[model samples]
Target: MKRSERLVDFTNYLLNHPRKLTTLSFFSERYKAAKSSISEDLVIIKRIFDETEVGTVETFAGVSGGVVFTPAISDKNSQEIASEIAALMGESNRILPGGYIYLSDILGSPKNLDKIGKIIAHEYVGKQIDAIMTIATKGIPIAQAVSSILDVPFVIVRRDPKVTEGATLNVNYMSGSSSKVENMTLSKRSLAPGQRVLIVDDFMKGGGTLNGMKSLVHEFDCLLAGVAVFAEGPFKGERLISDYKSILKIDSIDVEKRSIDVTLGNIYTEEK
Candidate 1:
């Protein structure tokens, strides 16, 4: 194949199989090209990846070594996406009855969610994440997107127990807004002991739900790798957990005025 054609194929392959290593011999043989030629092709591909700021192509030396594609969103790209979402969140029509912002549209958009996932995954790149965990419904998309980029499994915590789950581990948590105790259950077989878990959620108010998830991680004997949220809203009471990250920080909400203040979160401001 021509070098240009081979470059296209190589780029697609690396992107499709993120985090998986493929040796130089494998690529050279697949393209019917010499190792020297394959190496040159990779150099070109790596340059493009770096220039685009989408990800990085890392090469390893030695007989057993290979190249791995690590997906990452640049700070500029992350801020642009966050700013766009903040504008979307500012829509007046999205205001709900009790000052809640209707974010179903934003969460449901594949384009938005895909970028959000990449941004969140970028934060935990160097960490060990065995699996992604989140509550059922809205959080499922965020969890799945992160898992896809990280090449890991994701587990869901359901509010209602299902017979199909077989055995379950249940926990009670206080509702952030309602101030009522609620029960959340997870399938016993979903998560194993000693795994590192990254917890994600769509929105956070009082952080009651996130706290519950942290407890669940301990109950399963797993270490908490990190906690991330798509958006966090203001609450009258103190947050249950303070060590979490958010992509968008909601400063204020007014039900009567139908307005909200949204801005980029700690990802851009936090020290690396």
Candidate 2:
């Protein structure tokens, strides 16, 4: 292949496998090029990646070394995206009867999820995340988004039991939104012991559900890598989770007036 063709192919290959290492010999053999040539191509690719803020390609030295592609977005880009999302989410027409904001459209959009996933994945980059865990309904999209970017499997925590999943481990906890006790179940075989799990959810009011997920993680003997909520709404009382990160924060919701105060959450301030 010509050098131009090889560069395009090499860049595509690395883009497909974020945070994965591919040896120099493997690339050299695959491209039918010399080690020196492959190294030179990587330098060009790495420069493009850094300049674009798309991601970074780190080349390690040694027998066990190769190159690993890490996905990243600049703080400025992240803040811009978050600000746009906050404005879009604050529309009064999206308010439900009970002061809840409608976010299905945003969550369901592939374009939106793509940006959301990239933003969330960027935060957890370099962390030892084994799997992404989320509840069955709304959280699935966000979990899938993050997992896809991180190149990891996502596990769903269900409110109801399904026989198809075989045995399940169920945990009971308070539902922060409804203020009612609820049970969440996860497949016993879905996760292995000692895995580092990142819990993600679409919306959080008081974090009751997220807390339950944390308990479930302990039940499976897995470590809690982190917790992330797409958006957090103001709760009546104290929130159960304080350490979790949120993409957007709903400061106030006035049902009568149908107004929402939305702002970029702590992730932008903390990370950026």
Candidate 3:
């Protein structure tokens, strides 16, 4: 293949397989090019990736060495995306009957989900994240997006158990929004002991559900990598959890007036 064709194919492969190691030999053999040529191509690809703020290409040395692509978005891009989402969420028409904001449209959009995933995945880059965990329903799309970018598996935590999942582990916790006790279940096979799990959710009010997921993580003998949410609403009482990241913060929702105050969340302010 021509150098131009090889560069395009090489860049595509790295982007698709983020965080996965591809040895120089593999690329050399695949492209029918010398290892030296492959190394030179990687230098060009890495420079472009850096300049574009898409991600980073990490190359290692020696016989066992290889290259891995780690996906990331620049802070400027992350801020722009988060700000746009917050603005969209602030529209009066998005408010529901009970002061809840409608986010199905944003979450369902592939374009939006891809951006959201990139922002979230960028935060966890270089961290040891085994899997992305989220509740059933709304959070699935967000988790799936992040999982794809991180090249990891995502597991769903459901309110109701499914027979198809076989044996499950259950945890009961207070509902953040409803203020009632609720049960959440996860398949025992979803996570293994000592795995580092990141908890993700579409929305968080009182953080009770997130707390429950934290407990489930402990139950599985796994470590809590971190918590991330699409948006967080104001809670009347003290929140159950404090250390968490959110893309957007719903400052206030005036149901009667149909107005919402949306702003960027801690995702930007938090230490990198």
Top candidate on lDDT is 3
Candidate number achieving the greatest TM-score relative to the actual structure = 3
For residues 1-272, write the lDDT of model 3, one tens digit per residue. Answer: 88899999999999889999989999999999999999999999999999999899999998889999999999899999999998889989998887877889999999999999999898888899999999999999999999999989999999999998899999999987788999999999999999999999999999999999999999999999999999999888889999999999888889998999888999987785
Ranking by lDDT: 3, 2, 1
* lDDT of candidate 1 over 153-224, digit per residue (tens): 999999999999989999999877778899989999989999999999999999999999999999899999
Give the per-residue Cα lDDT of candidate 3 at 150: 90
How many angstroms is residue 96 displaced in model 3 relative to the true structure, after the best TM-score fit? 1.1
lDDT for model 2: 0.92
Please list all clashing residue pairs in model 3, or write none if there are none.
none
Candidate number that wins on lDDT, 2 or 3: 3
Badly placed stretches (over 4 Å) of model 1 are none
Question: How would you order the candidates by TM-score, starting with the best?
Answer: 3, 2, 1
Instruction: Give a tens-digit lDDT track for model 2, residues 12-81.
Output: 9999998898899999899899988998999999999999998989999899999999888887888888
Q: Give the poorly placed runs of model 3, Cα more than 4 Å off.
A: none
